[model samples]
Target chain A: MFAEVLTIGDELLTGHTVDSNSAFIASKLTEQGYWVRRITTVGDDVEEIKAVVGEILARKPEVLVISGGLGPTHDDVTMLAVAEALGRKLVLCEKCLERIKAFYEKLYSEGYIDDPSLNEGRKKMAYLPEGAEPLENTGGAAPGAFIEHKGVKIFVLPGMPREMKAMLEKEVLPRLGRRKFLQRKFLAEITDESKLAPILREALERFNVRIHSSPKGFGKYIGLIIFAEDEGELEKTVEYLESRGIRLEEA
Target chain B: MFAEVLTIGDELLTGHTVDSNSAFIASKLTEQGYWVRRITTVGDDVEEIKAVVGEILARKPEVLVISGGLGPTHDDVTMLAVAEALGRKLVLCEKCLERIKAFYEKLYSEGYIDDPSLNEGRKKMAYLPEGAEPLENTGGAAPGAFIEHKGVKIFVLPGMPREMKAMLEKEVLPRLGRRKFLQRKFLAEITDESKLAPILREALERFNVRIHSSPKGFGKYIGLIIFAEDEGELEKTVEYLESRGIRLEEA
Candidate 1:
């Protein structure tokens, strides 16, 4: 299956925040044998988000994972954008409200908070799209939501990396079980990438592999990746490279 | 000015590579007072690249920064896709050839290597669009290229973070100078973010501020960021908060 990640936040665009959520989601989706086709980061603008979502959906990716803008703030407009993109309506989820209220009551009883802000933060999590499944969030006040529209599953997650990760692991992964796929990575300690062209070409000719070479730190080391759909084919390609004395390392 | 970043590579899509180039470009663009509207990462597939480029151009961003797929591998199809997107022809550049050859000669004179792979690598860097200007790479074998198409200035930098960063700072930044912008960050030591909502809303009401309350480890503290376009307004808002006995720590 193919997927695309949409990270929404103006802070990311203004350099006030670094987008670690996309990287984290990409890694997890890849580990689960899903091809994360594209990642798009947009500001909190509704028009921009809608435009990007439309473009991504046109590409026909099976899954669309979105992170950020799920807080109790003015800039948190991800839910509205998602509803607009999917041609749906925003509705206050009763279950989500109950969960949020329960969380606030627990926090108040534990003396963590004593003011009305607890209910305010909890209320923020209650707004979601119609016919959405609220994912349990153990890390923060915002509960994630998942909605499937026109064969594309969209997951709306929090911008916080820890909370996004926790929800993905606990809620998203179970729904998307294992699939048949292959991924191989090679780490080479070569100083020059120019010298590896012929070897790379030869490897590609022998196997149906997508090869990517990325140099790091003045060409101190280069990361070579080989992706394929068949596991045996991937192994054979790695073995062929090993025979040519090109060291193969796993990521 | 507004900008968009396009990173092309299968390794990025398959999770074999973590794209650091977009983050680096975003930070640089932000520092230069340019709003990075979106950062789109896609595979090396030509159709995917074409689609993203088309959408980005349609949005009419002032600048479009592209990284990755500049290598000599089979999956290195960014140049072709870019050419197709701009309706331009891929042509070998004479100056780029001289630069690449000179780079190889320098390496050879320094007793690095006398292999023919150097020439191949240089030839790879010499290929450019018909009217594109080649950006020199003092760090690696791949030289970047710059093209202005339909009012959107597109820069093609190597996927490697170091090379992309060096080229962006040395070439891209000086061309696109600085702009006046206001950025304010406050670190609140409160374990509960609920206590800060009212004050945050108050700060926003006083100034055009977007506050991001990022809770850190075990709810120890919430890092607050208030970014605006007016420095005086931000200062007034901060002073108001401080005067109200709301402890504001400079970030």
Candidate 2:
């Protein structure tokens, strides 16, 4: 399946933030056999966000994952943009409100804040899409939301790495666990590409592999990847490469 | 100005490669007042490359930067993809071939390789899109290519970070020196969002600044960013916030 990652924040565009969240999410999705076609980073401008979202949706990717803008402030426009793109309505989720209230009460009891600020923090996380499923936030105040529209699954996640990771692992993974996947990789120590050209061409002919060669400090390394339905076909391909003196490393 | 980044490699999609090239390019582009609206990462698939290139052209971004697949092996299909996307033909550049031959001859004279794969390496990098301008590669074997199509400039660089960075710094930055940019950032001490809400809101209204709060650690720290066309306006905004006891620390 193909996916697109949208990382929302002005800090990302300004060079103040590194945007580790996209890399993290892309890595996880790729391991599960999802092809991340594009990663778009935009500031908090609603028009820009809406425009990019509309463009990505037109591409008809299987999934669109967005990270950022789930905060209590003005720059938190991610939900608003998603709603605008999908033509949904924004509403206060009562269950999310209750959870936020409980979290605030715990913070109050622990002397982390006064009652006034606690209430505001709780209210900050109460907003959600009208019919979206609010994924419980065990790591932070803002709960993530998941919704489906036009055959594309949209996951709106917090910008914080810890919070996004927890929700993705606990809530998102289970929902996508049924998708079958095959992971294959090849490693070669040859530095010169010309020397390995004939071998790579032969391997490509015999196996359904997409090869990548990266030049490292010591030598150039090549990676060959393939996806198969059954373990038998996967093994046979691995054996074929092994007979040709290519190392099929475990991914 | 607007730009789009294209990172090409199967390893990037397969989780074996983390695309630092896009982030680095994005940072540089943003610094130069060029907004990087979309970044596409594709495998070595020629069709996918062509599709993304078409999409990028449709967006009419002022600049298009692509990295990877400039190697000599069978899997390196960037030249072919670029030719297909721009409706051009791939032909060997005689100047690039001569340079590569000279580089390899130097390496061989130094006893780097008795039976050098110099011709193969040169052949891999010599091909270019018809009428494309060559960007000098001071660091590696693969020289970058630059082409202008329908008023949109397309830059193709090798995937290796060292080569890409060198070309960006030496070639891209000089060409982008004509644009003016204003970026102002403030770092504030960690505080709860609720407690700082009133101050932040007042600061935003009083100075017309945009604030983004991100929780940092046990004590939450916030980052405020303001963008403007005039440097004097940005300074005045910063001064106004500081005068209001917002404790602005320049970042």
Task: Name the best candidate (by DockQ).
Answer: 2
Q: On residues B115-169, what C-alpha lDDT tens digit does candidate 1 reach at each position?
A: 4344465476678877898888777667788898888889988887777788888
Ten residues in sequence with the least summed lDDT for candidate 1 chain A: A113-122
lDDT of 1: 0.78
Predictions' DockQ, in order: 0.45, 0.46
The residue ranges of model 1 lying beyond 4 angstroms of the native Cα positions read A116-118, A187-208, A215-223, A235-251, B110-118, B188-213, B216-222, B236-247
lDDT by residue (B165-206, candidate 2, tens digit) is: 999889877766455556676676544655556666676676
TM-score of 1: 0.88
What is the per-candidate TM-score for chain B? 0.89, 0.87
Best by TM-score: 2
Residue-wise C-alpha lDDT for candidate 2, range A61-142, written one tens digit per residue: 8888889988766667788888787788888888888787787677767876556244454476677777789988898778
The lDDT of each candidate is: 0.78, 0.75
Task: For candidate 1, write residues A1-251 as lDDT tens digits.
Answer: 78999999877776567677887898889888888888889987788888888888887888889998887655677888888988888899887778777876777677776553434655766888888888888887788989988888889998888889999999998888586466766787565666667787898888876677765533436777777889777888888877877776775
Where model 2 places Cα greater than 4 Å from the true spot, the runs are A114-124, A189-191, A218-221, A245-251, B106-114, B118-122, B194-213, B218-220, B243-245
